[model samples]
Target: MFARRRPCRRPSPDLRCRPSGRATFAAFAVAVTLLPSLAQAQCGGSFSGFVRGLKDEALAAGYGAATVNSFFNGAAQDPKVLKADRAQGVFQKPFVEFSRRLISNDRIQRGARKSQELNKVFHRIETTYGIDRGVLLAFWAFETDYGAFQGDFNTRNALLTLAHDCRRPDLFRPQVFSALELYARGGFDPARTTGAWAGEIGMVQMLPGDILENGVDADGDGKVSLKTSAPDALMSAAKMLSHLGWQPNQPWLQEVTIPADLDLEETGLLHRKSVADWQADGVRAKSGSFALRKGPAALILPQGHKGPAFIAYPNFDVYFEWNQSFTYVLTAAYFATRLEGASVYDAGRPDAGLSGGEMKQLQKKLQARGHDVGKVDGILGAKTRLAVQKEQARLGLPADAWPTPALLKRL
Candidate 1:
């Protein structure tokens, strides 16, 4: 099962997701101008072709001759990273289980303890940025297990492999160039630069592009080091949140009880209205009276209508920006609530999600049936949800957009 948490708030335009290929467009122009000459330099054929292309891309994107050589390290697409990319375990879990795993009692206790230790520092950051301390701590714990594990993949190699892969080069290629920039000006050493499988480095697992673009020297150390510096990571995260549109006085999500008779189909972020409007439609606070008067909101069905429902605020989109999975963002938001002395979420059902392999099979069936579900990577996304809803409506099943074995079997 999956659980929903949160990463609320917004970032500036540049602080938002990296621009599509434009981060290095200038360099790309440079490379294009020198393409004929650059390729004439005799890169070994076959396996070296991709690496050579990447090298040219870096140089074109405006990195110096020395920069490209030092950055790439003769990187080629690594099978392990590719394998890891194709199979993400978190996206396959049901919401309740996913939430429990991320924000268990032990983790909650640890978060509280962390709060006491860093209370002063977080308060200061909060005063300056208006981001929640609990949310920042939750990001730290989930991203690196309170700095226990910050991944071990070679960032350049991982980005290199992903960039070479056909699945999402448009996404990873920009990241590859971004990492080179970090090497150039952000003071990251390729020899020691390692992070998440997707090349997200630092304690909070920020991508190199994001780090280079929005990194802040929180501790006033003149250099921003997210890996070794908690202040830097937290402050940088705040900048990203602000950039993405995080409202200072607003709650990202709220536990609300949706009426059974009210149109359950009209209960998702897409079918959004203000919390006031939702309340007028009979949505009541699950724990107490709703108090998110500072921002507009939407209802999120993390586990469909059978599970708990919440009114999502404008900042909910930021969580979606942080991690595309509804369950993950819900867990993040819920975890932040826990740090602020809230109870564990009372989920409404034992709904479970399909396994990664099973989801892939469902994706295949949906694709075969002529539904546009993007790639069959076993990750549940909007297109898959739309297709599933369409199929469910056709099959006389409730269009909850939650995947299950029964639906999979029928499809």
Candidate 2:
């Protein structure tokens, strides 16, 4: 297995590495059209043609032709990256498994130490940005394991491959141009620059477009180097989140207890009701009560009724800008809670969900029976939850809204 990376809101930049013998995909970049020595050499066919087209687009966008061609020349297809592009995981592990791997004892310990060591920086960011330090730390650790292992792919090469592969060209194309745009502004070189497979760069794994638009010069050296500067990366991340409407001091979520007899329809994020409404619904606050955020919240049964339940709030939407997965956001929130000195989930997670492949099969079965669970991407999401609930009700099983092998067999 390879270390997991992010997939952003727009196919924009969920790029990262894969562990298969020959699997990897990363993307989006900028211009390349120098003094036109060999337009014939640079503009051939296949990905080469695509690269030339990208160059023209960049030039039309006001980038220097010399800058564009310098980056585009000798850009060849990366089959490994293409293989990785096609191999995006269709199934997802359960919250329990996913959380365990993402936030282990060692990770928690590191977070604690980082919080202690980076107090001034975190404090500065929070005081200025009104964001929680713990949440920022979670983003940092999750993105590159605290910058321990950012990928080494040539971002331009990776973006080049993804852009030409014909799999979501609309998404990767802009990203490639953005990366080139970033290079045009200087400091970034196509050869020296590298990052996640999808061309995500920096400690916080901000996409190139995001970096260009939202990156901060936290270090104030007159240059923004997310790959090398911590202050710059962290501050940039906080700024991006703030721009995305991160509620200052509002909890991303809180662990809670749902009564066994509670109405199932009231659960899920869409049924957002105030805390008082949830209290009326018999949801008990197992975690510390939300003193500041007392209003609108939604009950999220990430691992179902048997596992830990959380009350998510508006600020939780910021997590979507980082990743679209519910489990990932929950994991990040839980990790931040731990960094803030909170205990592990009192309810703990259940070990009953189906594995990735099993979930994919279950998704297929559900699709066969006519439940549109979206791309059948096995990481059971909202549509899958509704589908599972419908199936459970149809089979006269309790609509717990979680996947299980037994349920699959019954289907």
Candidate 3:
């Protein structure tokens, strides 16, 4: 198994790693006349041709030939990066299993110690950016084990390989230009700089585009160094979250208890209700008080009704802008709470869910039934969960968005 990484909204940087492998490179004609936007459609033709086109695109954007040439000098396509991209089966694990595995005692203690050690820097982050230190620390722990293992993939080749791949070229093409921008500013080393398989850099595993846009010089060294400087990484992470619309001091995810008779159909991200409305529906805090946040919240039953429950506030929605996986986001948010002194979540014994093969079969059923469940990759992604919920509602079961063995059998 490989270490997990985060995926971000749009083309922003995130973190991940997977096993490296080699694939046969394809060849295509060299036509270096199209603009970057138009050239994205032509990624699958050839690797060398794509790099040449990317170099031409850079030269046209006002970069000196020497700098652009230097950036692409040793860069070559890495098929291992592509293998990693298609191998995200780690996200298929349920939240309880996933979170328990990730939020270890060692990590929690380290996060607490880091909080105390970097109190001044975190204090500045909170005061200036209104982002909780625990939130950033939780991500830091997950992305690279607090920078302990931020993947050793070649940054330039990783970006170019993904940009040349046909699956998500649009998402990665802009990052190629952004990495060059960082190189131009003397921050990135095309040959030496390394990061996650997806090309995220530093402690938080931010992408090149995000680094160019949100990187901060918090240590006042006049450079935004996310890889080596904790202060810079933490501050830059806070800035990025704030830019993603994190509400100031508002609650993100809170553990809560719900009455057994509460309508399960009203759960999931699509059905958000006010805190007062939920309180009226007998949803009480598992600990603390409901007075902490007064805004709207979504009752996320991540592993169905028989598992851990959380009331996700508006700021919680912002987490998706940073990472797309529901399980990963919930784990990160819960870890942050642990760092902030919350108790271990009570993992209610959820009903047995579908296995990987069973899940892919269910996705096939969902697809055949006309619901757009994206890829049938065995991962219960957002679209698949929504399809599960719809089928559950139709089958007169609890539409809590958790697919069970029985649900699969029914389909």
Error of 3 at 328 (Å): 0.2
True-structure lDDT of candidate 1: 0.72
Summarize candidate 2's per-residue lDDT along 1-411 as a digit string, tens digits: 132333435433323211121111121221112334311223225766677677766566455667778878778777777677657562276677777878878877888888787788889888888888889888888889988888887888877777676645555565676676566667468887888777678788876777766778876899998999888888889988887778786777778888988876567766788888888878888865754347778888877777888888888877876776677778898888888877788655554888777888998999999989887666787788888888877887667688787799899
Residue-by-residue lDDT tens digits, candidate 1, 270-375: 6666677788888898887786754467777776777867777777777766777766777888788778866666688835768888989999999999999987
Which residue pairs in candidate 3 collide? Answer: 5-15, 5-16, 6-15, 13-207
What lDDT score belongs to each candidate, Candidate 1 first? 0.72, 0.72, 0.82
Tell me which of candidates 1 and 3 scores higher on TM-score. Answer: 3
- Each prediction's TM-score against the native? 0.84, 0.86, 0.91
Q: RMSD of each candidate? A: 5.3, 7.4, 6.4
Looking at model 1, report the run of 10 residues with the lowest lDDT sum: 1-10
- Supply the TM-score for candidate 2: 0.86
| Candidates sorted on TM-score, descending | 3, 2, 1
Instruction: Give candidate 2's whole-model lDDT.
Output: 0.72
| lDDT score at residue 11, model 1, on the 0-100 scale | 18
Residue 81 shift from truth in candidate 3, angstroms:
1.2
Candidate 1 lands at a TM-score of 0.84
